[model samples]
Target: MGKNYFEDLFEKAFVYIHYDENVESCIFRASCWLKEANELYSSSQWMSSYILYLRVFKLVYIIPQRFRISKNASYYNDLLQIQKNTIQLTERLTTLQKRIAVMHAFTPIELSHVLQLANHHDPSTIFLNIYAHNSSKEYSFSSGTVFLDASFIQNNSLDAIRTVIKTPHQAHIKTAICYSCDNMLDDANIASKIYLSLLAMGITPRFLDLNSPAKVGKNTISISPVGLTNLGNSCYMNSILQCCFACSPFVSLFIDGQALRSLNQNNPLGTGGKLTTAFTSLSHQVRALQGQGVCSPKDFLANVCSIYSEFDTASQHDAQEFLNFFLDSLHEDLNSSAGKAPLPELTTEQQAAKERLPMSHLANIEWNIYKRRNSSPIADLFFGQLASQIKCLTCQRTSTTFAPFSSLALPIKDTTTSCTLETCISAFSMQEVLQGNNAWHCPKCDVPRDAKKTMSVSRLPSVLIFQLKRFRMIGTTHRKIETSLEFKKRISSGMIVPPSFQSSIYYEPVDYELFAFVNHYGDLENGHYTATVFHNYDWYYCDDAIVQPVTDFKRIYQNFSTAYILFYQKVDAAN
Candidate 1:
C-alpha cells in the first residue's frame, strides 16, 4: 500500500462523518488499525497483519450496523471500500496465517491482553502525532491535542478546543490524530454502549482551523466590539462612532459618567444636554452588549439630525465632515466654560508682541487663551495647535499666528500612485508660495505680494485625527482620488515636527499609535463607509451592523487606497 493510502482514506472518512462524534471516533480508530496492518504486511508478518486487518474490518463494519448508517450516507461508501480491502487481504493471508501463527510468538490471546491494558491506560499520557508538511516538524499532543481527551468530549468543552485551535502560528498544522487506540477492541459491547449514549445527547464532534476566529457559544457573552446599525445612509456616522469608541480615553468620558455631570444644560449653544444624554445612553447600550449583538443608534441619530438638518435625509455625507460636526456638538454640550464671562480682548500691539515671542511660548500662550473660552473634554482630548507663518517676499517680515484644530486635513498629491502617511505629513508642513489671486496681503509690504506660507504642528493632542483630502472639486462634480496610502502602526514625534522646530530644545518627544481608521469605498456620489478598529488586543472590521475579526492586517493598511480618516492616540515615548 502507498504511504499516504491510510491518510487519504481517513481524510475522506473525516469529511463524511465529521458531525457525528461516535462515527468520527470509530473512523479514527479504524484508520489507526489499518495503518498498523499495512506496516505489519510490509514486514512479512502475515499473522499479525491478519489479526490487525480483522480489527480494522470489525471497526468499520460496526460503524454502519451500530449507527444505522444508510446507503445514502457519505461514509457508507468508504466503509464498503474498507470491508472489500480487508476481505481481499484476509483471503491472501489465510493460507499463511496458520503457518505464521505457529512460527511467531504473537498470538491473538496475547494481543487481546495487550489491548485491554492499553485501554485502561491514562488518557493524559496519550498524545496525537501532528505532521506539519511545511515545517517538517511533529507537534506532540500537548500543543494542539489537549482537547481530545474523553473528559473534554464528554463535557462538551468546545471553548477549550477553540482556544487551542486559535493559538498563534499553528496554521501550518496539516494533520493531527491519536497514534494509539485501545478502547475500541478492549470490550466491544461497552464501547458501543458509550457511543450510543453520546448520540442520545446530540453532542457532535467539531474540527478546528487554527487560523479561524473563535466561535461564540450559544450562552457565552461575546467580548468582541459591538456594531452599530446603519439608519439609511448613516454609515458615515456609524464609522466615526466606531472609531471614537475604540479610543479608550474618549469612550471613558461618557462611560464613566463624566460627560453627564459636565453637561452645560443652560448654555444656548447646546441642546440643553439632551444630545449628551442620548449619546451617553447609546454608549452604555454599546458597552453592555459589545460583541454580543448590534445596537440601533436611531435616538442618537435623531438628536444629531435635530441639530444638523442636513443629516436628516437618507443621503451620503462626508465622514470627515460628520466627525467634525459631531465633535463640535459634543464639545458645546459639555463645554465647562459655558455661561462664563468672556476674556478681555488683546490689543494689536500685544498680539504682535505675543507672536514675536518664541514659537514655543507663543503656542502655549495662545492655547491658554483659547482654553479660557473653550474648556471641555473634547478640546482637551482632540484639540491641537498649528502655527501658520506668512513671510513676505518683497520685505523680510514674518508673521506667525497659532490656531487650534480638531483634525489635520492633509492634501494628497494626485500625481503619485502611492504614498506614505509620513510623506503626507511632510507635504502638509512644507512651505507653499502664494501667487496671483492667492497672494498674501503682507502688512509690512503694504501690498498684495507673493509670499511663502508654512504650517507646522505647534502642540500635540491626546488624540490626533488625520483626514486625507481624497475628494477634489473639479467643475461642478467632486472626484475621488484612489491613491494608495500606507500608514504605520506607531509614529514618532520627529515625523510630525516642522523643519523649523527640529532643533528646538523645548519640544518633547512623543509617540502615537494607531487605534482606528475609517475607509470609504466608491465615489462621492455613491460611497460606503466602514471602520477598522483596534479593541481588546485585536483588530475588527465594522460595517454598520456587520462586524468581523480582521485576520489580514496587510489588506487594510498597506497600500490601502480607501483609507479616509485615521485616529491615533498618544503613547509614552518609552513604549
Candidate 2:
C-alpha cells in the first residue's frame, strides 16, 4: 500500500497489529502511528497526539533491544519468554503506563486511577495504553529523542494542569467561574477578570467551531493574534516587517529589548531615533506573541512616519527601497561614531610639522589614521562582500576591488523569455565587455582601454537578500519585465560564488532556505505589494492586515507576480 493508505488507516485507528509480530512489521506499524501523531499535533490535538506518540516510542524500543539479543531468534522469542517463562501482558502494560505517566508528568497512581474510571473522564482525558512490547530486559524509558524540540512544554510533555483544566468548553468555563467565585467576585466582575487572565497568558478566546455558541470563557483559543492595523498604502512596510520578524536571529536581538539597550551608543543617522524605537517596539510586540500568531506594527509604522516623510504619504513605494533605507538608517544609528572618536591633541612640534605638508599629503595622512568598524547590526547580519575583477584586454593586466553589499540587485537579461532566479544570478556575475566610454582606466597602460569585467561573491552572509530588477527604462517609458522566474527552496553558496575567487576566502559552503519574499501584483506603474513569510515552520501569505496560511507551494513560487525582494536564511547545521 501507498504511504497515504497506511496514514488513512492509522488516522482512523483501523490498523491493528499484535505485539508479538516481527521486528520489521512492528516498525511499519510504528511509522504509521507516528504519522498520525504528527497530523494530530499539527491540528492542536495535544492530549490524544501525546498518547499516540508514546505508542511509537514503545514500538521503536524493540529495535535497540532486538539488536542486543540473539539475531537468529525473533524479537518476540527472545524477549517474551525467560527460561521458558511467559511474561504476563498486564506486566508489560504496567511498565508502559509508568513511562506514559512520566511523559505526561502525571503520577502512575493517578493515571491508574483515571484509567480505571475512563467512562467518567472526557474523551480527550482518556489517555490509554496503545502498545506493549515483548522485551524482558527492563530498561528505564524517558523522552530522549530530538523530536518535539520546539514544544512550548520543554520537558517533552504536555502541561497536565493546563491541559486537564482548559480542555473542552464546559470544563474551561467552570474553572474560570470557580476562580472568580473563589475571589468573592460578582457576576459583573467575573467576565472581565477571566478575559484579562486569558489575555495575560497570550490566549485569544474563540469558538472551537463556526456553529458553536459564543460563550466567552467556555472555549480556549489556542492561537492568539498580534493584530496589525494597516496604515494607508503601507502594505510594503507591513510585509517587510512580518518577514523580518520571522528571521530568528534578527527577531531575538530586539525581541528581548537587547537592540534598544545597545542603541545607547553613537547613532549613525542623527534622525534615526524614531526608526530605531519603531523597529524595537515591533520586535517586542512580535516576541510578545510567543510564536503563537500574528502581531500588528502600529507603533513601527508611527515611528517610520515620524522619520521618513515620504512613507507617511498615501503612496505605494518599493519594498526593496524601504529595506535598503531601513538598514542604512539602522546601521547609521548603531555604529555612526564607531571609529570616528575624537583624535588626540597634537603637540606643538607635531602641529608645525603637519602644517609644512601639501594639501594632498595632508589628506593622505588623515586617511591613514581613519579606522574602519562594523556599520550596524543589519550589515553585520546580512552584509556580504563582492569582488569586482577588471581585466584590460590590451595590457592583459587585471585588478580587483572588494565592496560591501546588503542585497544583490540582479538585472533581468531578457524581458521576453522566461527566467529562473539562478539565471538572473548568473547574468549578474557573468563577465561582460566594458568598451568605448565604459572602458576601464588601466594604471599600467595609463589609458582608458576596453576591458573584461566580472563580479563574484567574496564573503557570504548568514542571510542572503536578492532584489530582482524587474522595472527597466525602455526607450523613454519605464516598463516591467514580464518574465516568469523560478526559484528553489534551498540554494547552496557554491551556486553563486566563483571557484577561483572562493579559494582565497574562508568560504564555508552554506545551504540557505528561502524564507520570505515580496511580490508585486500588477504592471510596473500600478501594482499591489504582498509578502510570503515562513512563520512557525509554515508559509504565510501576508497582504497588509489580511494574513492567510498558505499550503500550495505554487502560491509562493508564482513567476507572474513581480518578486521584488527575496530573503534567505542559512539553514541550521543541526537540521
| lDDT on C-alpha atoms for all candidate structures | 0.66, 0.55
RMSD of each: 26.7, 19.5
> What lDDT tens digits, residue by residue, belong to model 1 across residues 1-575?
23563343233221122222455455655666777768756654544455556556655666676687678877767767767766676565554443332222111222222233346552322223223232323433243343233333334444544443333433433222222132211122322233333233342211121211121111121124787888999999999999988887787788888899999987888778887888889888998884778999999999888877898647889899899888888889988887778678778787666655656556677777788878999998999889998888988577888898999999887865778888889889889999999999987678999999989998878899999999999999999888888667888666786534432323444568898899999998699999998875588899999988888867666524568998998863212
Highest-scoring model, lDDT:
1
Error of 2 at 498 (Å): 0.9
Task: Judge candidate 1 against the unseen true structure and give its global Cα lDDT, from 0 to 1.
Answer: 0.66
**Which runs in model 2 stand beyond 4 Å of their true positions?**
1-227, 268-272, 289-298, 341-371, 415-417, 559-562
lDDT of 2 by residue, 258-286 (tens): 56765634454534456777777766666
